[model samples]
Target: MTQRKRMMRVPAFPNNAKLFALAVVLALFLAPAPARADVTKTNVGGTDLQANVQLVEYETSCRTTESDSDLIQGIIMPRNPASVRSVYFYFPGNTSEDAAVHEGGSDPERVCNPNTDGKTQFCKIVNNNQQFAVVTFNRNDAHTNTDNWLDEASDIQCFLREARTKIQAYNMNPSELFVSGHSGGGKQVAWAVANGGVGFSKTIFWDACYGTQCSSTAPRDNAGQMYLYYRAGTDTQADAEKAKQENSLKTKLVETTLRHPAIPNGCFLDPSNNDLCGGRGEEKGELVVGTVEPPFPLGLVFDETQLIIQQPQPRITIPGLQFSDPEELRQLIVREPDGSVYIQIPFLGQYLAAVYQWAVAAAGIIAVLVLIFSGVQWMMPGNVITNILTKAGGERQEESQNKAKKRIAGALIGLVLAVGSYVILYSINPDLVEFKSLRIPYIIPKPLVETDEPVDSIPFSALPAGAPDPALLPTAADVCFPLTRDSLDPRRGISWNWGSHRDGSDSDACEADSDRCHAGIDIYSKFPGQVVAVADGIVKDIRHVSRCADGWGAEGAERPGDGIVIYHRSLGLTFNYAEVDEGTSRVQEGQEVRKGDILGVASYCGMLHFEVYQGEVDRFQTLNWCPPGGIDVTERHQCATQNYPRPDALANPNDVVRRLEGNFCR
Candidate 1:
């Protein structure tokens, strides 16, 4: 472990600070390498993105012993002083390297920290002495003997401790931390959000969903702190469609913030049928924000400075785009790749067998007690053993029977207690639960799934020719939102996106994009107060989105997918959230908002939908917060916000607004 600890540290010259400075100087003064850590640097940026960039690294203990100089790595990307009121951590995708990691089983060897080996991964730290910090440590565990490859959430917690230690020495506030991740990395974010402890408040998901990693028993985040996103697009027929899906997701999540739900902002997904997440990648930026128009933020630019320091992009001829569609571009050739499926088979079987054996052992113990009872009962003729009991006087035979019965009862009680103790112990420590669900039942040893039958069971058999044709789809619990005004709780307003399939409301019930009816509604102040407090007093803890609709317009709506939140005094009351078809905006803390005031419009899956919190909080059984009729619950739909546009790009802000006026579903 000690040796592993040393491996986790970032490598440096004689002086850590000076060496880092020198490394920065080298990158600033020279060319970037094609790869990293064969020395301690990464080639950052590409033809795709650019921005102010810096790469910093941090680590934790490896499992290897102290004496050995060998070890594995831990990675990090932190926002120096946080910004955008949140943070994101992208997870590495499934690749040849991951395939190799899996091939090694659960015990994938931990590598030396990249910084130590002279390799670099980019880390962005803001120079401000801000009070909050966003740490992104996506667990890179691919191999190991553990049940699940544990992401370093606990380790990250420990790292936060270290950060706090630094803060104490430097006399800074212990800042709040938020975590975000994509793909499998999203799973790590989910775990951290649920268990990341106090410093961590919410999560951002990219190209992922709860799936099984999010346990059913797990509590749902009600404050709207938890957000999920997925995006996909089409081909020549639909280059713009990709942008819509991404916009839609961001819109939905952003909208959720109004109701003060746990989710902060929906994910930004430029829809593409590409693969997995449909080509959501950029070499840079906190949010890959840019106007489809002009004066794009520098954050939109991909920083190549790091690359210039190492391997400069070669003038090598690149292959032409071969994909016919976004979907085609994303196809992966999935080979078993020398890795095991049902990898925990052996271990799981042992656990089951152990459990069964233990049960049988208990049964045997019960049987022994029964035998003793039987022997006592059978000693009817006053055998010496029996007489010893009946001795003094003519002890009643019935008394002997009663005595035997009591003994049996006592034995059963003891057995029950013993078993109970074992259960308690197992609960406290999972090591005691010796059972595993490693393999699917009837899994073929050298297995394969038959494709002849067609995997989608019903497939999209009777579908329209070009689009998804609305033919297929199958697919949370503890969740909340914001109330911006003194008007009635927005949550009591219209429920967005509660389509016929998922929430059981018909699509017709949803206002069409062409329809001017604000799809979501505004819950008016029941008592008409300027500052209507949420039903509860804890409203202070919530995080909220602060964008005006006019500023958001279509592009912001399509891009950010971000939302905001405000806590309530009551447990269940909430406001309405309707995503805008606009651009993302910046919001500051403690800004005063009015009752029935427009918070920010959300950019949800192509519509302005709203969810409500009127009934019980069961994940499956509640109604949406959308108000009656097609009226936007915001009371007056266009009353609250103005749209904001990205500075650069060819788009005319006026045109975007004009299109959104009609297209704005909310």
Candidate 2:
């Protein structure tokens, strides 16, 4: 159907005009932010990577030490970034410097051979620094295969921490970000997942990942709540190798992850567009959008509004063709880990221009289809048998002249009707949307190839389980939390999930509408503090509580009055008794009281709201945490849907409780 015109008022993009002004400012400050030559930074060759016109590079501080052999060489592609969220450390393919080192690996210069080429193109390809270093170690040919797996897992943690420090997004920020890599990079990343690590929100390892403890590998332990992806070729020669490594890594990572403190989302990608990646023998490129002078947008909304305006790079823009250094380039990859922010700019090349050449070819195909169909209908037009004569116009005459006249008149009428119908339909309907739902295939008049029919399939149980599905997901107990066998105390193991709950006006400065602030810290009465007369005043209110998950906000809100509350006239303090399975408050409401007395069981639903009030007012108001736009505190909670199993269903519930009580991090 023809598209109806939508009368939407074009929004005023005030940000656009302002952004254009900034682009002008950027063009002026296109040089590296450094004076003469400084010793702290590396002498990364000469190119002002952020210049407005072309690819330029500048020197970076590559002065850190690695492996204790020589000073570490770091080069950066600096930019006046809008806001630096991440940094990338790229280890280009095995360095030629590696080849020069002997079995002794005794290169004091940290210089051996250069990369095979001077103009080296780089990509992260691997998920994290851990896997990258592990792969690098194997390249040394000195370490045993056993070290690879463990190195993969732990290195990931190290890499994540180090990358964060270098990025300097915030000096004291403790946000865990992303890791991305390729091939051997893919293999390294897979190993990281298989072996697991302490931190890192998520990782993307493509074309690589190995089986557990291959000759002494970590059986894929300690992984975070990661999203695992595997894409392999079906008919290609390398299919076996790709599938083997993928399955191995998948098996190990999945098994260990499901039972671990955190379970990651594992996805074996569909093979439909199996060749999406630059797999062996596959097409190397495809058509994509190109920008001549792309802007680094800040608060430049991409969805809905397609307005393009030049915006100056807040941190630094790589300019037309180059980055300030390698660090800048690596930092742009998305999935630096899950929850972290990243962006990728398309590479400039002649090959890229070729992808858009199809604009003309497509037009030619439509022209040919239309011409052939029109020619067939021009002759013989309507069927001779379709005409029916009206009494007012004519009658059947056996004469040859009458027959000829009838055919001609009928043809004219039929042609007129068909043409009229096409025009009227065209006016009502126009361009169609890419709605796959309504599309149906037209029947082809070509021969059909025959194939043999197969027998009915057997039951799913008849087939062997190739790889296990992720463990039944944790219920709602908040699995992303890092707890261990030593932390939880059953007497008061489960507490209300604070990260999920929020109130307004915390004594601590916080947004009034956040859900991040904890209402109060909950803990079991492990030491049993003495309870006495709450105060000289009468009790204000008394109520028992239960699981907030199931029976909250109802008359059952205070059942059988398991707990009690106490009011102190002199101190203005109200102490709540909570989670007692059953018991009337021991003291009378108006009775005089003293120091120590038994309160109630420390329970989740059954809990206390203890506050110090002055007269009728509480000074503190609890509020949720509201991070600035685009930055997500919720990002870290990968297993938001994850829940703890029923206490009795846990394999080691008691041990888990200890871990939960004590487990401080993920």
Candidate 3:
């Protein structure tokens, strides 16, 4: 108030206008500075090249809530900026970024030297190229050693866009942008071309396609984008072939006998030199393209004597036992009883069971605490004389006593209900309350033996004395046996007859009137084998059928079992292979399968229920046709109108079984 401090009031403006002015001022102060480039002389390969090194901070789509900025150290080397027609963006692989630039190495006074004094394989190729500007970025700033490209895809796209602009500032306007990466970097290039929303002219994979990278949908999605898939003769060769087959026109597969690490450099160098490049024999570095006459024969045969050097074998350590093969580890983890292993409950079941156990324990503790609280209330002091003198106090005391009694009664009731329910469940079935892991036996599929001779070429002398003539009998051309020849023996394998009740139904009639009539022949095996496809067909449907109490034994009652339905388009027939082992299906719905391809192993009960239909009848559609408990009168009936086994599509599988038996039963 001391003379009002000679107050000078600033002019007031509208709120929106003030906000706009504030935003402008803040933006000016907080906005990122323009990327500064330091030009320096760097020796690459054998030539002295001018390199423009820049540290760029770019806004990335790594987070959705707010803008996030990331920094990358990039080096651009151009022989002639004016003559540049394309820009190659190279994303260095994990840990390889160190080879490009080191800390404190980007100063104007320092020379940008390659890690090996410009003698590295990659440097050799970089110095050879003159028409394109090679821009290499260190992604280690944003993503350290992580190989997943999806995490930094947005950041990469942002950097590329900014890089193009920076290159243009140097008086170079490149029309085409190419991306290439080695190993982990290759994964990045693949993702960028596939889903980065950037228009990359070409992508080069330097043995980068590994694991799911080979199965990437990028080739299919980017049909027009050109891809050069380089494979080092290793695990990735098979995967690379899959990607090339997706789009043969735009994709090329190149194979080299080099190992995974040496592929990037060896691919460009001539294969004739045995020193700098490893000993290049014939077909060492074969370039296979789509136009090549015969596709490059995959699975190259290498001279083991020349290649595989004898080394000291590492001793595998198992806590309690020693195993020569890794497959033996299964014996320790998986619980196998009587040559049968159990199929584990799904993840959801395990999670729910854990939650249920926790809930039960919590409920019991809460009930006990409630009882304790009630006991404390009962122990609280109350004077009889004082209560009687005051009527209101007496009534209050009475209410307190009643509340304690009610709480005690409620706690007791809760405990009884919890314990009684568990007891009842236990009495009904011990497994319901045992809380032990569910052990549903998983039938292991018998291994298929490969042989040079075909089944048709089998000598007649191999057949049993009473066996039918091999030539006269129906061959696998008609239908391959579901089980192997060894699995068709009555003693060692399976045994079944047509029109026999698997549920042990006493009814002699195989008519629809008898609900207990067996719909198909049941092939019972003491030890089951893999179930094979009956004919060449497409898998139409996969089903899960719950076992009825009357069938088999009560042990598997209400348990769901797997079933497969395959439709032979050429034959116009549908084959239903039921009671397959749960979780052991080798074929999927809509997958094409040839005759003798494994469908799955037999069921836990060592049985296969085989059925046939005249046309394309889905197994699921026939579920309602004469279903257990009968069809509802309120709904219209299609195949259930007649009686039990009512579907007219149903065809006796006896004839087919008899023909297959001749081939396998010997």
Candidate 4:
């Protein structure tokens, strides 16, 4: 070994070279290997796609149990991180079990691999369109209760933040962001846009939007493009139409013949095909889709029609020039190359009006200031210092005094003119001082008073041929009583008589011109109970009348409460069921009801101010005369015009009461 070493040691290696060799050997043996990215083979509509999936964890309060940690998992498939152009977040529909324990286990492969035909289309669309997809899992327990995604808006925001971070880790800087949901997931998508503030330019709802959130302008204003997809004839369709009506500029309703669960399959299979997935799929409404400039120039084009400004053109009037319509004004404002007018400033009239007002106010202020200065000069004719400086007295001082007197008189005249002009203009017409164009007052002609035409009252003969037997309970023949017999017992202080008013005043006598006469009968109960509809009718109106304070039917202690008015088209009469609890109203305006249907619970005041009108009369005619009852000035005015005991159509309800008491045979 000594001989071999001597032979090889002809040259010596440097210290640096020896160190480099040793480091290489150590690194090869001790260094850890690079980790492999998670890759999954997703079968999307018969096509196997290889995608780099990541399991991202985020903090959220949306959980099945309070003891459960805030941690939640989301699935992200960044097909090609370097080439990602957009990020599409998908919220799956409600599950029968907690999303983590569903059929696909915690892996969420049902949404990732997209086990369903409809879900597979989403994956395929994302994979083929250079778009990264993210799927969020919800903590819904079928056996317990399904949670609303809208209720946990904060959770949605947290998930989005974490998902974006995960995408960035793959070196993706997507220029566009998108959100989509199915069924309950649709609510999630809406909440994200409404409250998440995640800068999603495009949003889609699939068979969702059954609530008022989508109909709101906030989401539509936030998203650059919004598509509401619904199965034909579903509530979702109706809501989508409402959203379209509210935000016609941004919202586009896409109706499909496919079932709710299968909508994604049909719509996502080809998003660009208007006849297949777009609004034209079912050909229900007009859906205009074309390229247009975005609100801001970001070098990106959108697949939406240009916003057509439908604002009415401003009215322009000039002393010398008269323009017939807005087109003529536009032609006058903008000039052609040959010097003909062409362009228009829509706000010209408003601008000029504002300027005129400012000028008038400024002139008025200057006149008052001049008047004050003149008054001060006239009171202090000449001070000692002024006399010494002028070195004049007697005749000269008198001349100066006279000059000041003249100036004061002139200033007074100017002030009077300025102040009087405003007063005169205001007296002539309040609108003149308002600086607005004069408008002819529209006067509603007074109706002719007919002395011979008598008010129609429900006759006693109108009741079934028998006396009201209190012993007999209301039957099917009676349809329904205003108050159940149990709640209308005589011992409970309620009676079949109609003489006293709700205010405990006599309501028997009526004067033609008196507005204080009671227009309805007051029925009181000892305890609050169900108030049923007496006859099948359509609800005409509802009102908040008075609330209970110290106790039921207490004097001078009631608050604002609720009432309902129903129009019995068959009977050609309106039934005013007043003083019901607002929180308990079971019917809405225009809703049709059958006899015996519970209208609502009586107020805690235990009073039902029941009125029967001979014909269809809304709250204006029926409730206006009552204090603290009219909703608007028009209704209040009607109270003065149509005095109480409404002479034209008021009816006595004794016969009606008999019929409601089961006295009617048919």
Candidate 5:
């Protein structure tokens, strides 16, 4: 806490000759007001509780200008200053030119101040009725104005601590706290509640709902509550959308404020309507906010006729301000019950166990009482004198019969009482009753029908007349044509010379005058087919077309579209294929694919961008076939045409296709 010097009051001289006296009076009025604290203690007229109204004036360290003091003047009414269970601090909406500390901000006629008029709506609805205290503070030295109270949040926390310390002197439950505000003040209340780190019990917003963090904040604990009430007619489409998103954080419903049947006061328009409230219950024990958007001035009220309706838990709408008449705002706050009170009942086994225990205990007590009564009857026999003259044998016989009858009756009565007690205990808590030796049966399921059979291989006899010989390839049995038979026909389709080409460039390596290197052959077909896997391999990587759509290369470089990399572990080689139609990459990353399996359908980019790499090739950086030294076009073409070792070239994708019969032309 920052220390402040107190200015002492000096006596004024009336004599004109005393020039020093006039100077002192002028300085007091012109200079900044001294920091001070004052308290007014009064007794509530009809109640035992006492009200201690306090005024604390302090200068905040935050300042942007040389003339800015950033002084905060606050008025606090922890209604019963001492022993408060909770506190509600309200931040007002409007602004004023001069400081509110020196000049009272509220108009005597418009704003309610219980100190001046005890009959004010604020006093009736809040201070006088609720057990918690209420405090109203300004953002700075000036009148309440901007909703940017978040700027002074740290300073406000310091002030709150001092207030808590003062109230702690008289209150036992000083930890319980709450925050509220209307309009701009409400935004401040939200920032304080969400980011302030204080464990507030509840927060009430009246005709104010706007906060950057409002969409993410939630109640701190099970007992914490948040209520957002605003006029619907005054809300814009954007405001409604923002409100919906914020309320969704706590899974609440936002609806137009309507007059509910349960509220004693129907609609605000009706003359007889007094109070309105309503809320729907929730099952998860989470925060439930019932929003009603009524037009401004003639605002909405909640009609809370019943607390909880049916199944799940009850939706309880805590009391909120009626905006139709701002002066008619009512105070309604309902503290949530602790979560431990709701317990689920146990099933069959538990119920039977409780019953057995209860029965045993009841039977034991009843048997003991019966034995005591029998002993008393045996010791004190009636008609002592007349029995003594009669036969001793008849007395023993009569005693024995009575004893037997008492034993039977006591046993029967004990059984009945024990049975009745068990029944009652089971009804209350079925889980407590336990059944011995109970078994639950399990049902066995039947087998499922087999699905589609796997296609492992395609016969070479299906290839066209000019297809390359498969026997010359190293992995002849494993290789399969990449495209379907119909799309790879030799006569109608055109397969240009095998080479490399920088994508989207007009210079093709296959052309004589071109300077570019075209790494793969361009296969043009009017009717395309699904591109199958070259051999049995596992999918290594898959880059979808969405990546290229986001501009992968230089400014105007064409997108090679969706592509896949397959790793043939046995052959120690990798196959790269791209420019497949969207959603046609049948093989996913890490998927195992067999020969002749559909890898994807080649369609976009005019042709497929296919490449092959040897076991030691660096697929990512392998590009030019020519070395750094001077090399003619003939040598570069020779290196690209055949699969050979070089500084730039690793393997030719076209040569692999010819060697493995993947190419239609021999």
Candidate 6:
């Protein structure tokens, strides 16, 4: 489709002296005077239409910190503030380094002094023939794009507060606000509506409504109306079509979305392949005329003579509707806990799957035939009957019958055992066979195969019901010590000075600066052996954390290093060990471990920092515990001793060391 050509006449403004005088007159009689707005026609960004640019002073609540600036300069268009019935707000795409972080240009100013080089998506939107008062904002990078501020509810409130005042000032209805954007800006618009409490009357997108995230089939609070103008053959179209596939949850979801009832006339706009609809035209920048009907209703009257310009392609909208986020679309794809994604099979696939049941029936018939043949041979008097009929064949027939009867009997027994084994084993643990669905048509090609990655099998049920008997404990020759290749005592290069960095420290020995101090000991092994779990437990977590020694390497110099934490539910304790050699962890998280099982090698700094906490592992916080001091926090865990209670307060490991003495070489 092509755009209708029209000669745009740039509005002329009065001289500076006359404008100054008019400003003074308005200030004295009307209301508090804000910066005077100006009307100027200029080429903005990459648009073919000469945009009538205007300016409005705006400020929002978003900032880097409480002390930072909140001022924003909004770029507007058409110059006439009074003629607009609807207010359209837009966010710009990714900004440059100079625009994202610097505060030099952040002061309040007239919005059209080209705060962003005048080359932005907002410029293209504001330049359109639409009569709505279009405005776009400028914020620092932290408040722009994916910094989370775009999704913040407070930021939206700030914008609406300022927008409402501006709309009222222009004698327009604030509630008639329409929000829209291009690309990243569109994402912000969707996120803002879903999370922010403000309800916009309408939303429009320009080749930006994307992914399941930007469009939704459900009604969002205060944001139930929307329109999408997208390019054909774009990723956005792919996502939309995917959502509309047969038997898809999104197909049903679209039905529930807000829609306009059947059109008064059966003719809806077709926006297919409207390239000239959204691009800079030929030399002299004149809009080319196209005869195609606009895909979406152009509610605004353009030049009383013409009703069309190149309109955007693939126009779609849910009428009387509000926009919703894609995340809100439930049942789009059902996921099982085992990490398999599934969808209800289409009718054809279901029928095909159901047809496989005949195979199972055929196998059952074979088993019955085998049983019948064996019974017939066993019941018949084969040798005696054959001898009466034919003397020569009696001996041979008897021998053949005996062998065949035995073979048939064995085959029948094997078939019974095979079927019985499957039933029994499946009843015991179903994970061995991962089925897609338990519904009818239960026979289907497997839906998906989780990676066949081989992993160690250590089921918790396989562990002894209680702690093993003393005789079952590993001897010195069977296991290596944590601090040494041999014994764990001081004479064998191990530390006996336990709790060196805990409560007794006078600030020098503590690794962490917090009041709790370091809750466990450090094992500095010169020739460290493989670090092993001291008891049956589950490997809870594996992380790479920075190793900071005192104040050195405390900044960015510190980096992620290997670490592991195991939870021993039987012992009511959790053990965290760090500084493991890279790529040496043989066990994965959630795997069960037996006593003295090698967890990983101790490498790099040769210093393994270990900490033990009581009770279940709190995945959120891994703070070390300390003895009850003069600290004001009442919930602080006391030192692991006889004086403190069990479970909440950690237990000392001096006794645990003694129990593992025999497992380490002396």
lDDT of 5 by residue, 428-538 (tens): 986454343223221212223221222122223432122223443445565766665434433323243333233322322223333334444444322233477777788
Models, CA RMSD each: 28.3, 30.2, 27.1, 29.4, 29.2, 33.6
> For candidate 6, lDDT tens digit of each residue in 101-170?
3221222232232344323333333344335566555544434433423444445644655555556655
Q: Find the 10 residues in a row with the least total lDDT in model 1.
A: 328-337
Candidate 3 differs from the real structure by a C-alpha RMSD in angstroms, to one decimal, of: 27.1
Model 2 CA RMSD to the hidden true structure, in angstroms:
30.2
lDDT by candidate, in order shown: 0.30, 0.28, 0.48, 0.51, 0.41, 0.41
Q: How far is candidate 5 from the true structure (C-alpha RMSD, Å)?
A: 29.2
> Model 5, which residues run further than 4 Å from truth?
1-35, 41-72, 75-79, 96-112, 115-121, 140-153, 172-175, 211-213, 216-224, 236-666
Which candidate gets the maximum TM-score versus the true structure? 4
**Candidate 6, TM-score vs. the true structure?**
0.28
Clashes of each: 155, 69, 1, 8, 41, 9
Model 3 earns a TM-score of 0.34
Q: Rank the candidates by lDDT, best first.
A: 4, 3, 6, 5, 1, 2
Give a tens-digit lDDT track for model 4, residues 45-143. Answer: 364554643333344433323215324445455556677666667766666654443322222444544444533344445555555555555443333
Identify the superior model by TM-score, candidate 2 or candidate 6: 6
Writing each residue's lDDT as its tens digit, candidate 2 over 425-482 gives 6577733211111221222122232212211222213322211122321222322122
Ranking by TM-score: 4, 3, 5, 6, 1, 2
Q: List runs of model 3 lying over 4 Å from the truth.
A: 1-34, 37-70, 96-124, 141-153, 173-176, 221-233, 257-261, 268-666
Q: Alpha-carbon error at 457 in model 4, in Å?
A: 67
TM-score of each: 0.27, 0.24, 0.34, 0.35, 0.30, 0.28
Rate residue 294 of model 1 by lDDT.
Answer: 10
